[model samples]
Target chain A: MQQTNRLRPFFENITFDRDDNELVLNFGPQHPSAHGQLRLMLHLQQEQVVKAHPDIGYLHRGIEKMAENMIYNEFMPTTDRTDYIAASSNNYGFALAVERLIDVKVPRRAKVIRMMLLEINRLISHLFWLATTALDIGAMTVFLYAFREREYLLDLIEDYCGARLTHSAIRIGGVPLDIPDSFLIDLKRFLDNMPQNLKDYEDLIDQNRIWKMRMENVGIIPTQMALSWGCTGPMLRASGVQWDIRKEEPYELYDEVEFDVPYSDKCDNYARYKIYMAEMRESTKILYQTIDMYKECVEKNETALMAHAPQYISAPKLDLMTQNYSLMQHFVLVTQGMRPPVGEVYAATESPKGELGYYINSQGDAYPYRLKMRAPSFWHTGVLTDLLPGSYIPDVVSIIGTTNIVFGEVDR
Target chain B: MRRYSPKDNVQKKPYYTDRYYVAPQVPKLDVESDEEFASDLAAIESKFTVSESYIQLDQLVVYIDIADNLGVLELLRDERAYTQLSELSAIDWLAKDGKFEIFYQLLSMSRRKRIRIKAYIDEAQPVKSVQSLWRSADWSEREMYDMFGIKLINHPFPKRILMPDDWEGFPLRKSYPLQGDEAASWYEVDKIFGKEHRETIGAELRDCAKVDRYDTERFSRLGFEVPKGADISGGEKRKKVQYQEDGGVFLIDRFDEEKTVIIRDKDR
Candidate 1:
């Protein structure tokens, strides 16, 4: 009888025909540092990578196709699934697109609240990036510390909305709900404690010999390469482009607030680290301004968070309860949905990862005729093919860590 | 609860109708309204024949010939400073126009403007690849080809990006059903179990929470576990599930049924 091999299935992918030094290693799909469902096909000659091909789509949910079949309001919840760590950012990006299509000016108070939510989301997303990237680079303590602060920030977010992670907090034309009675106070406490916590994170890993050794001179993306690859947000900023959408094209309450768009010419992991740290500090500054604005607006007793465009926006709770006309309209809006203008609008917002844009094409229908999500991760993932070659195998993890891609956005 | 019905072609069926619903159109202005757009359009018209140019929602949208895509983008990149190829994809209009309107959204940081270059191509025409110009288009083009079944002429790696290589249908097409066609529904079964096993295995059980007490393969009786395909026309006695056995383990504390709390609230 022939001997049965126990490891046959494991060896099935290994090719018998190959050069002695050259090898092709499938890096992920199950790898912990893959972030989410990223399978990197790396061709290695000895220890250095010869060529890299990223085989994505492991997390593809066909959400764009699903969005085409859904109404605008129904699709808002699904937007939270993309770039899920910063769910409200996706929510705002979609909301901004629909609001632009409907041509409704959002209330000033709602704008303040939306800005607060977005900045808080940015903090959450960046902290998560910091934690995971640090862990990926072999700094485990920073992960625990960063997550501890993240939990507090999540509590603040939960106080505003009912959910923590996938917060479909923003609605078309305005925010869905106003800040709770305790929201500002909680936000203040969290913001007050944030600087010290952020400094703690920096003190832990930013100066560590091993962290610097692993980070510096690795994954250097030149300015031209960054722009050509459509890199935005911190990725572009770190590569010496001072383009911040909030600065260039101010959406929401960004123009009212003052903050610096930090950039560095180093264009490597270390430079990106410095930029991320600087951004978090800048977000804290933005939050302070939003809180001041929110307090000032609250004095006028402006409780109308949702815009007054009834045909485009849903009826307020008070209207739904008191008026029969509002009830009928609400029923229709929920059943069929609001039909935006028969045109196309592409709205881009600077999400923590990059410029998250939603392009909506409406053909005089309740559902979008074509909804294309320009996810930053999709392009960032594409850049890996160019970024990975000639670098050592270990640098792949550092490069991916700095890239900060969430597969939900990449595979959508 | 609603009665169970087949959802085979639900999208095709008329479910809700709003006869009074009026679709509003956003105003599109002339390109000469803005001096920058006028100059840009003039520059574009000097080299290639621009079919149409207009400013919609404050962004310049220009329609050009399909063949001039690469050249126009190159001109914009080198001369016009439109550095980033923000997005590239096709809108499926085969049902209405029998053509795909492929659009390239170009972003110029220097000019602080976004210009959309769109071109119409026939259903079977292979799109000219712009991967040579902007590296971002590599994946976006592959994804466009994958979703809409658009053919590409000069893409470096001309394979499916989002979908599997052997997938049967272009899912983003208007005619393809959202839940999928018959071939799509059986894709996993056809790949893993072969077509011969279709009758034995049946279609995919989509309801995640659906539990059939008789299905021995998936649903196991908590304490009174049984063999596969065992005759269960007659029910077995329900055994009490415990944290510890009746005899109790050697080193563990004695089982306390009264102290154990069971959660009944679904929301909690």
Candidate 2:
């Protein structure tokens, strides 16, 4: 088939007729508002939308195929790229799935540590959403403020796991290592300081009339529709659904933790914004609780956080500590790889966007037989064409940005 | 191509209902060949059962079958309670009889349960497309089609999802060449002779000259007492020492040299 040279005749002569008044507009593959190379072919009637055909796959990198070619342990690094903003959450989800398939019990302390990283990752992911969402709407200051918090979170993560953007901290059985002493202290300080910062963020955008006008009733998705559409995380909760995997299914000691599932009936851009803000606050509270648990575990000398071996060796205490036994254990763990069972398990977590899930099938090998990732942004992005029909073209940007669709996650 | 008319630019397609976009309204399809479906599929009917099928891994190793896939997916989304079409992907069973295995993950937000849906498709058969049910399935299905050569019927525009438009055959298929577009560039005749396997004169000299070379200078440097005839007997240890010295000298040169070209043109 020959390509259509002029999609809509940008420079053609302008004329109007009443009989057949329909317009076709291509929104993006490069448009910043489309949230990562998403192109929407919009059929329009005057200013209103008649239909939106989304053209995607520009960002697709065949992550599922790559997962097949790599060893299970080798693929842990790839999880970091899935949801780059909340890398730990993706890591946790993937690791948990593998762990479930293998049937290796996660120690309580490791679970708590994983939960802490997850909560922190949620905060980081939300902060990114806030920053980019605000940027898309021309709220430049809020972008800086949101990133200010994100930078701090990344610093804390770097202190703990060494890498900021793609930390493969969580392993199959547990995390690669226990939280550093400095990491625990910094986490405590961050949790203490984040609430007031969150308040500042709300003050900046929550009450601003311009912000309200831009977001309020635009792109409304009803609770019934949201549920029917398979929306999860804030998108579903913003529609007044009280479902959260952390509370309902309670994996990774989430049952032991106390937290509230923030929800709203508004089911619009404003509702999603408010829900995410509330979630950021909730994540902060979870952080403090996690820190307290970590401290307790440290006080009790919990060996679960400590790497175990065939022979007992005192924990390295620091990564650089060079003990003969520690070196031997590290070498063995790195080369041999942990073995899990021959079953399959799906692990879900309440990610910033929604319930990010990982499904693992183990054939009793170092690598999994199959691994699948459930990205919330992809689901949320699917609803955009539905939400953009009655709304203005500019509102499309707000809807897409508010959903926080990362290309890394989408393509993966 | 149609001529540019201003009227043609005015009308846009109606955004589908959120319910339709999020979850597909699966039609009730009565499937035959019941033996291929999983026994637990009956249990999935009571809830929002998205997919209930068996995929045979090898022979008797039952996984998920594609025969009743459409029905099972409809149940998971429309009935049993799994409303979220979270993930859709395919696995290439390289040595297995089936060409590819597609995996679907469904999440029931209300019920807080997740289940996996696997479907096995033969090399040429078109797999059922779920894009109509879950709009999110659009790109996922396209990706599967692009990478695994699995056809998803009813996809709005089932084009290549990941690879470039003009790219050849499905890249992820077991039959796809592993070397990719670089198969012809894997090696060069000049590379094989010029540097890669060029044996050094010193190595040949060492092998041919059987005269024992012993030195106390090396043993003292490593804080070991020089033993008589130990240098020739400890060739392994000497080689290790040479490698370490080479590494140290290379490191020092790397730091000291400002515009040093590590490789010589003669070698290339």
Q: Provide the lowest-lDDT 10-residue window in model 1 chain B.
A: B5-14
- Per lDDT, the best of the predicted structures is 1
Cα interface RMSD of each candidate = 1.8, 15.8
Point out where model 1 deviates above 4 Å. A1-20, B1-14, B18-21, B205-268
Taking chain B only, the TM-score of every model is 0.73, 0.47
Clashes of each: 0, 51
Which candidate gets the maximum TM-score versus the true structure?
A: 1
Q: What does the i-RMS of model 1 come to?
A: 1.8
Candidate 1, chain B, TM-score (2 decimals): 0.73
The digit string of per-residue lDDT tens for model 2 on A1-412 reads: 2333667544345555666788899998888777678888888888778788766668766676566556667788988888888888888788766654544567778888888888888888889899989898989999999999899989988988899999998876677676777887778787888888989999999988878988999889987667555678888888888888888877877777678889999888999999999888888878778877877877887867633433212244454276776666555545544434455556677777787877665554445556667787776766775767887777777888777778788667
Which sections of candidate 2 miss by over 4 Å? A1-13, A19-23, A306-340, B1-65, B76-79, B177-268
Query: Per-residue lDDT for B1-268 in model 2, tens only?
Result: 9876332112111222233323211122232234323323554544333343332211112235676677777866776676777677777664566567777777665655455677667778888788777766776777778877887677778888556665666766655433343321222322445444433311222122244445443233342445653554454342112323344775653453334557758768
Q: What is the C-alpha lDDT of each candidate?
A: 0.89, 0.69
